[model samples]
Target: MSRQHLASALILLAISVALLGALQLALVLPGSDVPAVLALFTIAACVYAAAGIFAWWRRPTNAMGMLITLGGFALLIAGLGNATVAPLEIVGAVFSTAIFAVIVHLLLAFPSGRLDSPSAAATVIGGYVVALPLQLPFVFASADSREFAVASTTQRIAGAAIMISAAAILTNRLVRAQPRTRRILLPLYSYGVIAVLAVPATSLVFTTLGVRGGVAMPVIQLIVLTGVPLAFTAGVLSGSFARTGEIIQLSEWLGASDSRRGPLTAALAHTLGDSSVQLAFRLDKSDSYVDEHGTPVKLHSDTRHRGQVAITTNEREIAVIGYDTQLTARDEDVRRAGQVVAIAIDRTRLANELIAAQRDVVASRARLVDAADQERFRIAQNLHDGIQVQLVLLALEAQQLANASDTPRNVSTRATELRKRIDAAAGDLRRLVHDVVPLALLQRGLVAAVEDLVDRMPIPTDLVTEHENPALTSTVENTAYFVIAEALANTVKHSGATSASVRIDSNPERVFLEVKDNGRGGAVAGKRGLGGLADRVDALGGHFSIDSVPANGTRLIVELPCG
Candidate 1:
């Protein structure tokens, strides 16, 4: 509780304690009749005071508790009407029935402690005006005067109308309430309505019993009125227990979930009954928190739209949950909610962190793959422009030497053989460069690259393309190119395939490739090339598979998405 609420509670506590002792003075006062009246009155007033204090202390942000407190104190002030002293009797008479006005206000406000509509507010104001200001004239005049009697009748009728309005307000609230709220508010408001209407109910009971004044009415009224506060106290207890139950259910629900941010966040929202609540995790590698989707989120007071409650366990901040600030006014209660669900929050946080870490690792692998591709391209460029030119020049020099008029036949034969060897070497180097990094795959697209590859293969290879996107992502292009190349290489090297078919298709989401070879196959994924290819595919949030049986053809499938 805040210091202000604490102070208010302390003052109320002192007054409640004092009222217990004041009951003895009421016993000896004039018009006390018997000790039973003081006992019942004091007990009923104490119930109100105690229930009000409990409500106020539990929810200091609400005014219902203090309102009930006022009603209880007002009831005590009204008891002074039993005194014979003129000053005391006048003071008591001023507030005697005024307790009903305060209760009317309390009932109109119901559990929220604020009149939701103008009509309810006006009704409460009217009740207070009729109970105190209008009744003042009657209290100051002679008890048997015609004017006082008319004022008394008017006050009762006004009180009755105000009571009916408060009851209608409650009924409207109950009808419009959501299931969760209505379930708790039903029994709570029922007791309050009964306590309000019971004053007349007890008078009717007296009329039926044919008794004018006795011990029976006071005792029955006390019992009936006492249930109001006790009902409030019971509602408070049930609400507390309900919160506890929700917290327990939170843990159990999180245990069965995938432990991702969305499910975990939704579980907390359901527990708190606040759909706008969001969970952001404090990742070890990040300076700021990220939401369930691993997107960076700024925890600020921008727009003042939500309140953030930090959940820390073992002195380390796990996460911060943002909720509707107006609904959850108590920061302390929000803190307690975080504490209760700390384990679930931390579990989802770790899961998100692990996912982020895995993504980073995949990105690192992709970077390395790109680096390797660049290095191979550089090597191919060097060989094509530098060594290949040098080999051509040497071959030209050998041709010139062989064709010389004075050249020996043996030397010319050797020169001819040297030219042939150089030409063959040059051809091999070109093929090697082409395999290292194909120009079609880099500059054109996957379809063109596969076509080039199919044309170069010694065995007959069929190529199919569907919805091929020339603007495919570089990551998808590189990974898809290499994976298909590896699978084909494996098929040729091990499967003894006669012919192969390659089908490449594309959509907005991803590129799909399938390579199938009609040959005796016995390819294993873990052997060498497929293992690394599998990791590469998975890292990019794609799929990869290789199928090879002893008598069946080998088939390789790969899917790659840029995002």
Candidate 2:
């Protein structure tokens, strides 16, 4: 509880105690002449009842609060009619009993963490009913005399039992509930103390008054009789109005719009500080989930928007902001305060996806650039290693022939050797053009083109495929052709094994091609021709991975996204 609330409670307590004590004294000592004391008690009871009712009617406020105020009024009336033990005394007695019953109910209703659970609700109600009859005898002692006294004392015991149970329930439940405030306990304790004091005080006042004036004017009795009822009614009205303000705030934040709704919402937000609020946004009111914090959270799913809507109301009337957050905080004040500070958080998840795509695009372009340069270098090397050497040998042979005799057999032999050299050069040129852009890729589909590569491989090989594919885009077909060519070349040059296998597969989402060789499996990607081939595949946005373990043959798998 805040200091102000605590102070108010203490003040009320002191006043009630003092007034009851003074009335008791006035009854014992005849010359005290304290009519003002009686009036003060009446006023106190009235005010207390009003405050109690006001508190009770507040939204989320317990019914027990109303009962406490009512109980006080009962005591107030009973004390006022000490001399005339007529309707006032009887009514006062009934009020006092009601006060006890209501106080018990309120204390039980005091929200303890899990103690306010449905099961606990039942237990609390049941406990109150069972313990109530024990106090019955204390209300009406020995019907023969019809006198009020502590002759039974059962009411006190019952009250004590209720206090203990309420305390135990509150302690156990509040720990789990993690309530934000301890303000409620004040009222419970206050009503208990007042009720206890009033009972004994009333007994003493009436008993002594019977001995004087043949019937003493019951100053305390008069106050208790009138004050308690009036106070209770006022309190209920005020508390209800306060609660209405709160509910209006919730509705506004919820974003409800009715003729009266908007005003109520605005008023509530103003009353509660810093509230992030959603006004009248419909939610399923059923669907719930466990949040990241492991809290069992529920969301209103019935609405069109399934997510939570929150509002933050600031000190400024016009600047109410909204956001998403939890609503488990028990203090209405804190919830209002949170509204003021909460900010709109933007999640750019879509931007992150674009960044990833850009990275892939850049990486693919770089690989294509490198592959082009590498292919040019390979063609140059082939000329130097094969065709150019053959040309040189032919030149040397021609010179020797010229220096030898001009005979038919020697001339014919030289001419035949010259033809062989020319043929070799023509073959090299054709091979170079084919490597640049295989014509087979255009005339035949990917499978046919790949089969041509397998046919050329020197090693024993098996080709397994179930081909049901659309006519691939030119770029896709070219990429596939080169991949198979590179795999075949690698197997021939490096595997040094008896067998190899090539498999092609496709699905709606992607195309998959794998080449496996039973050779010394240490074939790493990006080594020799294989690296250039892998780069070619990358330019087409396909993934390339080579699993080449020490004793296991290499498996080169490429997965290309088609969709």
Which candidate number has the best lDDT? 1
Candidate 2's TM-score reads: 0.38
lDDT of 2 by residue, 1-563 (tens): 33346447746754664565456335423543555655554555555555654444332223434454655555465454442435544444434444444444544444211133565465456444434454445446665543434534544665566556655665664455423333433443454435434645776776777644321334544444444334333333333222333433454444544444443334433443223333232112223222212233344444432223343224322122232223222344434433533321111112323444565685677556547645755775676567767676776676566456674786868776776676567577667757765656657788877777778778878888875775555556566667777877877887776798999888776778888888888888765577876766676667988999866787889876553
Looking at model 1, report the run of 10 residues with the lowest lDDT sum.
Answer: 236-245
Each candidate structure's count of clashing pairs: 0, 64
Tell me the deviation in Å of residue 154 in model 1: 44
lDDT of each: 0.75, 0.52
Error of 2 at 438 (Å): 2.1
Per-residue lDDT over 306-363 for candidate 1, one digit per residue giving the tens place of the 0 to 100 score = 7888899999998988887765665565677778778867876887888887888878
Residue pairs clashing, model 1: none
Model 2 ranges with Cα > 4 A deviation: 1-420, 470-473, 536-541
